[model samples]
Target: MRTAFFVDGYNLFYGLLAGTDYKWLDLPGLLAHVAHVQDPASHLVSVDYFTSGVKPELATRGIQSKEAQDTYVRALKAKGVQVHYGRHQLDPAKAPRFIDKQTRPSRQDKVDIWKLEEKETDVHIAVSMYRLAARQASLAEDGRIDQIVLVSADTDMTPALRAIREDFPAMQVGVILPHRAGIERPPPGSLKDYSHWMRRFITEDELLAHQFPARVPTRKKPAIKPEYW
Candidate 1:
């Protein structure tokens, strides 16, 4: 049996470690843990990670932590995070404007974060979901793809879930809430189809058990300072 997992990167990271000490939970490590939780009967058939790159303008205000984010994301790619870059839209109206003071003119409402939004993270997720569902349908038509696990809460995925249930009658769709283990689901209209929802939360202990701390493995401190001299 085969299975595919789709992840909303920002959604899972924010929700899971919002206030937890596991601020830097190991990305690759967590997926391994999830694979184990999903099924020991088979190796992770395919792991697909989807997310948009940080916006250009947010380079300052520490909005874009490309170094650290990339480090972690790189690890995932090495272990397998098929990242898909999304487009960033700029709304000039959002840029700061100010009235002149004297002389020529002066405007000082300087905000560097020009734009920020995953314009298509959800769309990418939906596409992947449907693709996997189609794969499952093909499998069902034959006989493969046992269990499908999705690590996301965004209701946009509801339709994909619906299609899987309706089309691939043989596959099992499992929803894993890395953070919203116990939170309430979105109200009715918000989620198109959730009648067949099967939910479960990832326990804190589980997260702790998978911490892949971000730290340099080998680094030595300076010998000593000569301020006294």
Candidate 2:
């Protein structure tokens, strides 16, 4: 089976790597690990990673985080991961709202708080996936994709997955939920209801197994893992 992977960068980072030692990850290695575990026979054709650039002002580490993220993005591209960027938007005048899911409030309380939102990632992923499918749909049997692996737990992607399944019944669509190490973080049943299959991202053993080296030697510039990560 020929497969393509679509990764939601922020989703994976926050859900699995945040506050963990897996921040400096090898994208290709991680994808290989996923292929080995879930569908060992599938041949990986491409890896599309969607993410937003870090804002220096909003980040806790100021410019340091942005620099590190830039280096990481470069490294990913160097290693053959197709990096598609969205953007970060800062809304300082926006009010912060808190919602209690259990008890519905008529109007939630709002406080003045600076908000940093990552935008266009969901749309980018959806569009890219559909484009890939459409392009492959016209290709020869050997050149066409047999499966698409979406490495995200965001429920917003359900509609796109459903459309892909409906449009091309022969193509298999799967979801891999971003999960913490040793924790059970299953994808919502609603997403599973549309996908051909669903699985949790490998967090502990696979993360350690696929870690990037301390230094990545690139032709343009050598990339180093930030110490604070």
Angstrom error at residue 76, model 1: 0.2
Q: Write one digit per residue (lDDT tens) for candidate 1, span 1-229.
A: 4556677777786767665666455555666566665556634556667766655347442444554455555655555557666666665444444445544333456544445456787878777776766765444443556667677767777887777677777667767665645565553443324433334566767777776534423233221211111
State residue 127's C-alpha deviation in candidate 1, in Å.
Answer: 1.4
The superposed Cα distance between candidate 1 and the true structure at residue 15, in angstroms, equals 1.6
lDDT for each residue of candidate 2 in 1-229, tens digit (9 for 90 to 100): 8889999999988888888888898978877667767777878888999999888887889999899899898788878899998998878764536566675544355667777788999999998888888888578898888989898889889889989988978888888887865776555877798888777656587778877888888877678899897
Which residue runs of candidate 2 sit more than 4 Å off their true CA positions? 93-109
**Per-residue error at 25 for model 1, in Å?**
2.7
Worst 10 residues of 2 by lDDT: 101-110
- Write out the backbone clash pairs for model 1: 2-145, 181-201
TM-score of 1: 0.67
Q: Where does candidate 2 clash, by residue pair?
A: none
